[model samples]
Target chain A: MNFLAIIGRVVLALLAEIGRLSLFIWQSVSHIFRPPFFWRLVAQQMMRIGYFSLPVVALTAFFTGGALALQIYYGGNEFNSESIVATIVALGITRELGPVLGGLMVAGRVSAAIAAELGTMRVTEQIDALTTLSTNPYKYLVVPRVVAAVLTLPLLVFVADIIGIMGGFVVGTTTLDFNAGVYIKNTVDFLKFDDVMSGLIKAGVFGFIIAIMGCFHGFHSKGGAQGVGRATTNAVVSASILILAANYVMTSLLFAN
Target chain B: MSDAKIELRNVHKRFGSKVVLDGINLTVPKGQSLVVIGGSGTGKSVMIKCVLGIIRPDRGEIFVDGKNVLKMDSGQREAVLRKFGMLFQGAALFDSLAVWENVAFGLIQGRRMKRKAAKDIAIEKLAKVGLGPEVGELYPAELSGGMQKRVGLARAIAADPEIIFFDEPTTGLDPITADVINELIVDRVKDLGATTLSITHDMSSVRKIADRVAMIYKGKIIWEGPRDRIDDSGNDYVDQFIHGRAEGPIGMDVLKP
Candidate 1:
């Protein structure tokens, strides 16, 4: 009975948090329409969440695409289906690898940064300062991040998709015996707008999850330095897990033939 | 109308098995500087957080300008928040943005002014905090501790709030810098004609900047009076804390192995 009660309490707590989160979202959306929009913060968040993140995302995509191309080339040759290398690389990167890898990379960098930044603010009481100034901390801190993440992740993924394909190209043409023209042509042919679009959509969802997890953990951080550390770790791990879980669900819905 | 800018009545806050704030009652008159002093873990920070709604009280009411903050809708709460500013313990500047941008964050994001105007105001605020426009071009990580604290102060005052919260604002600074900060706090607050509430264990800060001082012990305000009377507070807890004596009412618990 005690264990059941604990479980029930946990569920209730989760429901309460969901309710709070939804309310926060509603307030943020209303603020988006309200006068005195914070364009500077929006632009600042865009640069922080998107531009500074480019190097890590680019590095991950390049390596993953290269590795995937090599692996597929070797495996496909054994099955006498080596011509599928370009198609497989293109499809994989566009449909699964690009968005998932990009999201995960961003989750590692951006989530940790957000959590740390906000956690420090929490512990040091800058968040309290925001409130004392007659400003909403959620509106001031969470909204820009969430909005920027939602809007900019697609653009980041678009860049990631292109970089990843290039990575596969380098390996397929230079290391493998595939014709450069054919590889490029096959990759182009296999990729539809929907395939690319799906990845971008996933990116948007992943971005939202990352930002939420970061803000939630930071906003609720306890103790001091150690607590902030825990919040940052939780932000990264939870965001990565959520990104993967969300990718599976999204992919299934987008491609359930 | 009540002259009190903020009033807390019978406030209570608990975290699981521990009660962080117990029936906290305090008042700050308009344009007055009130400092809350206590030992570490005495809930000095928690009490201030409760007033700002960073942590909600389990029971009781908080009024800012005679408005019951606990009962306000998000819209109303945010409106109330706009009247406040804060300086955090560790100078919680956003590392990503240049110094000016951090100061102007509220003006641009919460107020939705143009970037040029915001940046201009940001620079001006930075100057008020004894920083030049060149310093505004740098990121928080590039700044020294004193600079960061000054920047934090700039950000806090950026919106020209009618109320300000200072959380351990001088704890981490060197004596000279701490004195400078204390003076700046007094100067800026006086300039705004703002009501101020600050939490700190630093006696020097309390003496230099506070019009009145309240000492919290074990989640309650044990003593409160004009700053001049703190030396003769006659309460053992307040005496022990302000004098930095480990004996008397405050026991020295083993902090770590």
Candidate 2:
């Protein structure tokens, strides 16, 4: 009975927190349409979230694709299905690994940075300082980040997909005893715009999740140094988890048709 | 022009079970500087945040230039915010942007000025804060703590606001640097003829920058008077706080821990 009561209390508290978060998200989204749009800040965020983030995402995708290609070929040859290696590698990377892994990687890097930076600002009363100056912290800080992520993650995913496919090709041709021409042809023939588009769409959603979690945790952080640290960890963990969950749901939806 | 620039009436703010601001009532006439002074966690920052609309009060109203801030629409709030400038405690400069870009953040992002023009004004503002044109090219991380504070001050004054808020403007600086920052603050406020509100535990800052001093304790302004009368405010909490006594009423409450 005591365990059940504790579980009930925890669930209720979580629900309440979720409800508040949803409200905050709604307000943030609504602020986009309202006046005093900070376009410059949005552009700056795009540079930070999208541009600066590229090297990491690209590097991760390249290695992921190369490893997938080699591993799939070895696994497939054992079953005498070596001819399908390129098709399988491309499909798997585009459909699953590209979006999901990319999202998680970006979450680990970007979300933690955002949370730590903003959390420190919160502890130092910088957000409050913005308000006193009559600047909307939401408009100045949150909106730019959210909008930038929503816009840029898809681009990042698109780039990541190309780099990942290239990685797979390098592994296939150089290490897996496959002809470069055949591997390229098979990859091109097997993948569809829909497959890539699905991944890109997932990227967009994952980006939003990463940014929202980062901003939310940072904005609500309390205490001092320890609070900022907790917020950073929470941001990364929640963003990664949400990205994975959302990827599953999105993939199911996209392929269900 | 001669009116109560900012007014907090019977404002109350509570963080869970702990009431942070309890029935705060105060008025600052236009172009005046009012500094709230108390020990750490005494609700000085909370009171200023409530007035700035950064933290909503559980009860009561805040008025800026006789306009009810809490009731303003998003557009209207942004408009009101345009009249305010703030120098945060830790100089929350955007790390990704150059020093000039950080100073011109509000002007460009909030106002959408062309980049060249923004850069020019940012340079000028940097100069006002004792930073040279060359300093504009450096990132915020490259600056020392004192330099960062100067950059923050430059950003606060960049928009040429009618009112300004300084949150612990001199808390982390060396005594000489703190004094320099205080003088810059006084000079800038005078130049703009801007009404000002600041929260600080630094008695030197209060003495140097404040026209009036209010001592807060247990989330309320226990005493307020002209700066000259602070030494004889006749309130035990105010006396203890101003004198930095560890054996007084304020210390006794904290001593329980």
Candidate 3:
């Protein structure tokens, strides 16, 4: 009975946490459509979340694409070498790796930053201060990050897709002794529009998850510096896990025939 | 009081099993300052937070300007919240924003005033708090604790709110600095003719700002009267707390150092 009670408590706590997160998401989303929108703040956050993160995402995509091309070339040497290498690289990057890897990178950088900023605000009573100042903290703080993330992630993923494809093209032509024109043609011919579209859709969802996790953790953080630190770590960890989980679920649904 | 600007009736709030506010009944008359004083963690901040809608009470009715805030919709609650301003303990200035932008946040965002006009008013309010116009260009991180507190005060009063809340306004400062802030608060509050609700353990601040005083112990208000009666409340907890004595009805279970 004692063991069951412990298990029951853990389950209940998990359920409670899910409920809290759902409530936070609902509140943040609802506030997004409300009037007196902060366009400038949204722009500022886009700069911070999407713009500043460009180089890291770009670098990651390039390296991953090149490595993927090399691996496919080595492993599938028995198959139609040139066609298979180019097609798989394009399909893989556009469909799965682009959004997933980009989301994880952003989830690491942006989620931790948002969580740390908001968590510090929370522990220091700044959130309460906003409420008393007649400003909705959701609109002023959460919405900008959420809106920017939702809008920018797709853009980031698109950029990643292009960069990743180029990385593969570069590696195949220079190292694998493939004709550059043929590689590009093969990539274009095999890759469907739906592949990229689905990834971009996933990017949007991943963005939502990242921002929500960070804001939720930050807003609810208690204690002081230690609590803010915990929030930052939780934001990154939860966002990364959620991004992967969400990517899997979205893939199954989006790709279902 | 018929003229009550803010009133709480039998407010109860708890975190898990720990009750932070237990049947708190309080009132602040229009244009008057009511200060709640207690030892640390005695629910003084929680009670005010409950009033501000930052923390909801488990079971209670909160009225602002005779309207039941607990039952109001978000739109309605926001309308009511416009009357309030708050100065938090740690200053809680937005480090991301310049000091001027921090002060102008409410005017530009909440009141929808033009930025140029708001900037002028922000500078004026900063001047009221003994901050120079040059100080407005610097960020919150550039300021000392006392200066940050002043900027927070400026932000709180920027919108000319009719009601104000000060959460530990005199905390984490030297005696002279705390006194300076307390005097500024009194001066600024008097200028606005705003109703004020403040929570602090600082006796000097309590004496300087409060028209009426209430003491909380173990989540309940144990004594309340005009400021003059605080030293002679006839309540043991109140007597012990105000005298800053360790030998008291409160903290009985904790061992003396």
Which is the better candidate, 2 or 3, if ranked by lDDT? 3
Q: What DockQ does each listed candidate score?
A: 0.44, 0.45, 0.81
The C-alpha RMSD in Å for every predicted model, in order, reads: 4.3, 3.5, 1.6
- Which candidate leads the pack in lDDT? 3
Error of 2 at A83 (Å): 3.4
Model 3 misses residue A117 by how many Å?
Answer: 1.3
Question: What TM-score would chain B of candidate 3 score versus the native chain B?
Answer: 0.97
Which is the winner by TM-score between candidate 1 and candidate 2? 2
Worst 10 residues of 1 chain A by lDDT: A29-38
lDDT of 1 at B227: 94
lDDT of 2 by residue, A97-159 (tens): 888888888899889988998898888776765665456777778888999999999998888
Q: Name the top TM-score candidate.
A: 3
lDDT of 1 by residue, A1-257 (tens): 99999999999999987787677657656766665555667899999999999998988888888999899877768763445878888888888998999999899989999999899888766676566555667767888898899888899998989989889888888898679888888888878999999999999999999898888889878789999999999999989998998988998999998
TM-score of 1: 0.80
Q: TM-scores for chain A, candidates in order?
A: 0.92, 0.95, 0.98
Rank the candidate models, highest DockQ first. Answer: 3, 2, 1
TM-score, one value per model: 0.80, 0.86, 0.97
